[model samples]
Target: MVCATLALALVGCGASVPSPTPTSNRTTSPAVTSSPETTAPADAAAVFPVGEPREIATGLSAPWSIVFVGDSALVSERDSARILELPAGGGVREVGVVEAVQARGEGGLLGLAVDQDRRLYAYSTGGQGNRIQRFALTGTGGSFTLGAAETILDGLPSAGNHNGGRIAFGPDGMLYAGVGDAGSPQNAQDPGSLGGKILRMTPDGGIPSDNPDPASLVYSSGHRNVQGLGWAQDGTMYASEFGQDTWDELNVIVAGGNYGWPDAEGTAGAAGLIDPVLQWRPDEASPSGIAVVAGSVVIANLRGERLTVVPISDPSTAAASYAGEYGRIRDAVLAPDGTLWFVTNNTDGRGDAREGDDRILSVGLAG
Candidate 1:
């Protein structure tokens, strides 16, 4: 949403990795690592199982995100500034589109989620700043009633590059928002600041009354460009984030937890900060959207161009089993047919582009 770019003096100039994209597809490209180790098996490909990822739709302009509504509702798209619905039988049509959104480099519609009530949410970097808006959907795979977007919260740092804007709802039923540093590394450690933090709020554009700090909107801090978030069955929030070059991470989030981002990279734990449940080389896994299913955490990689499934049995444990190589995966979710539905950003201006490279793909995994 915000499109906040880091300052040239801070760290935007001589860049090593590519920037963060806001929509479903971009020519750009980009998951994670050893535990404290959560992974599948030594022969992960053999242990969990796999399926072919076919191009379910084509001619999509940078499809950035994907979310399945109920058993038949499917929606996806990227910087083209539109959310398209894919019917169960076949065919596609526009469900809803943001009219005032000005599409630019790495900015537009990015993240999306369908609540238990069938309401849809779009996280978009618009003309002003990144904001979350709600939309109504029909059971026939059609969504309408583009209601007024109530600005539940605002004033996120708008970085042209690292404006992290992934939003999710935890099992607790509270809406969670992931925001980047707005390019300011200093803010990552500042508990008072909202940038580079995971924010918790109510479904109706309101913050919960029982948040860690009554006046604070930030749930956790010390994140660089947190793009992906999912909740474990035990209600543990696992957030996937981008690190400098050495340590990208998958953190187990607790309310009011301080993850220690720019302060520390990988698994090093500070006195008051929590360490990552898993860490990876930035080049190996620039993880974006993440989905936890059955007993695994499925991380969608942006730069590494792979999807990694880490297996775990319970919380309180430190290690997890890992395995996977689904390339260029971005947004991912468990489909109704016991499959993992994921989207690709192979054409988002970063990674290698194939014919119909930007597509929604699904792979079978044990339910």
Candidate 2:
């Protein structure tokens, strides 16, 4: 019965929404698989969002990521290079601008992450290439400001699109970054290249001793454009990837695992290649930032314009909410209060901008 359901979902219901420009000629069917190590928490399957979404803040221009520092929320604006802070009391203010951010088609100030020491980490496109930097976050609340930028990693491949800028701290306290192929398809297959891989490094930007290659930062490879990284309580890592033309993927990330990119897309069932647990068409799911909540992996979709909830217990099944209700959803994260906070991307030079085109909104969660 589970296999039947999985097969049914492979042929997703097509939506009338416009699809992104095609990047590859691969046309294939969706695939689904189960990982024994990915079982969700006992109470996770019952957790779901309740009530209407409330606006936490508005008037954001092309915001990309949200990370909480204590009671304050820090948001990264993709084109502006400004980090906006939303205090617990309400209202938003600019913390400071990240220097040397180059905003192109899809490259600019992207992911934001906060460490235990109250320091901030950002992944962005720069004059040389894409880089990751750490900053000392000073002050609190409205007076919060960012100290000088400290380069952690730099010289990564960069392009107008497919920059794959998403950074996060894993449960192991190691920094992880998702990088794209930068319009170079062969780069995904090149193990020596930093492009099209998930890199794991220490807080100080050193490669972890236990990394797949002790001297290298590459954790996994063969990814087209990975924009989301999250882990369940059990430490099962999940990622969302943008496919060339055929499908978008939800992959279970493993150390040194090779995901077929230029060779095979969606589910080729090829030997020596890891297939995604679930795949969606580009129009129905241009998945971006994701958050692992309770028992489900919540995904933010751009072309699909929805929040997709996939139960970890049943990886093949999916439930989508607010399809086309909001325009071009970009990022979703679990707020400090357990509510689900999501950012829209209508004002990002794509999609039709609404009155408040790009805003951060939150909805209550219930079990």
Best by lDDT: 2
True-structure lDDT of candidate 2:
0.83
Off by over 4 Å in 2: 1-37
Question: What is the per-residue lDDT of model 1 for residues 236-283, given as tens digits with 9 covering 90 to 100?
Answer: 567889998787877767677777778778766356766666666787
CA RMSD, predictions in order: 9.2, 6.7
Candidate 1 wrong stretches, greater than 4 Å: 1-49, 74-76, 142-148, 314-327
lDDT of 1 at 268: 62
Worst 10 residues of 2 by lDDT: 1-10
The positional error of residue 211 in candidate 1, measured at the CA in angstroms, is 0.9
**What TM-score against the true fold does each predicted structure earn?**
0.82, 0.90
* Candidate 1 local distance difference test against the native: 0.66
